[model samples]
Target: MQATQADFTVLFRLLSGVVVLPLAELARAFPDEKLDSDAEDAWQSWLERFAARVSAEAREPELRVAEMKAANPKYIPRNWILFEAYDAAERGDYAPIHGLLAMLSRPYDEQPEMEDAYFRQSPSWARSTGGLAFMS
Candidate 1:
């Protein structure tokens, strides 16, 4: 049987079941990382329970991935676009910025006109600038 023939639901559930340890590790690893004070306080108040929940969610990889993807994205306005817009702004041009905003508003769709440029795979500059291909 090929991998796809496997029960994906069961596979994902099993994956989630195994996420518990990592989540605990992550929480411990990031304890000093600054976060929203109120949210952090609330989270810490129930850290143990929440950690268990995180592990449970991880057990269901498909659901976990879906949840994150829903909250995140697979594309974003490239930094080059932002730079172009900023440059245009400095020169009193707004078309680039306007076009970029429009593209951002419809990120999922492949705008053929932009395929040659903005639609290409994210360039290295993005990573260098700490911009991910996927926006949150």
Candidate 2:
């Protein structure tokens, strides 16, 4: 529930070129009220610094993206997922539990089928709900 839409969007952008995150999209996701210019500049500078460090290593762009993707998981076992699994288990239907287990097995892979169900930011319902955060 702590995850924001912008956070997931940023991760997607980073997994792409990382240098191509649209300034307008970022500004919309994190408006001036949410993030001041100083904070924005600081983060922009941080990305630039990180890019410079990566440039120093001179790795292939594709290889760098692969490494980033390998290091960063596209999916995580969200609390709501576990809840759904457990609820299904309580109903004596084990398919959801099996699916959850299968999804968890490859947290970093781009399982596109599971994207809508699991990959994005926490749902609005989940944000106000407590205990969902208990799931890793």
Candidate 3:
């Protein structure tokens, strides 16, 4: 679907599913759709208003870091990560499993070493290759 200010405004209203995105990213997400200059200006204005609202809400002293952490998980177990861990276990190499557990143990903490390999989205190959796209 085309990305519009109304759609983004609705998404922002949800709060839980809201994601802060750049105008360029929004354009890229809906490459085929053309937005007029007025629409683009409206989107920027909406984003600014949304940001101000979020900032104002954040000023409340009752908001706690622990509460936010509890509400949101730092890591989500992806199918590709699990598949790799299982594959390694079958080959008598348990490091992958151990690494996964270690990373999950402190999900909120940044693991710079594992960020690229384990924390991000599944690689394109995982989606394109045979037997990797879906669970067996």
Q: Residue-wise lDDT of candidate 3 within 24-129, one digit each (tens)?
A: 4444222233467877787678767865665667444235334544565545566777888999999999999999999889876656797557544346567666
lDDT of 2 by residue, 12-43 (tens): 53445453343433443331214556666765
Worst 10 residues of 2 by lDDT: 24-33
Residue ranges of candidate 2 with Cα displaced over 4 Å: 1-19, 23-57, 133-136
Off by over 4 Å in 3: 1-49, 58-66, 129-136
lDDT for position 75 in model 1: 37
RMSD of 3: 7.4
Lowest summed lDDT window (length 10), candidate 3: 5-14
Give the C-alpha miss distance for residue 81 in model 2, angstroms.
Answer: 1.4
Q: In candidate 1, what residue range of length 10 has the lowest lDDT sum?
A: 1-10
Q: Specify the highest-TM-score model's number.
A: 2
Q: Name the lDDT of candidate 2.
A: 0.62
* Colliding residue pairs in candidate 2: none
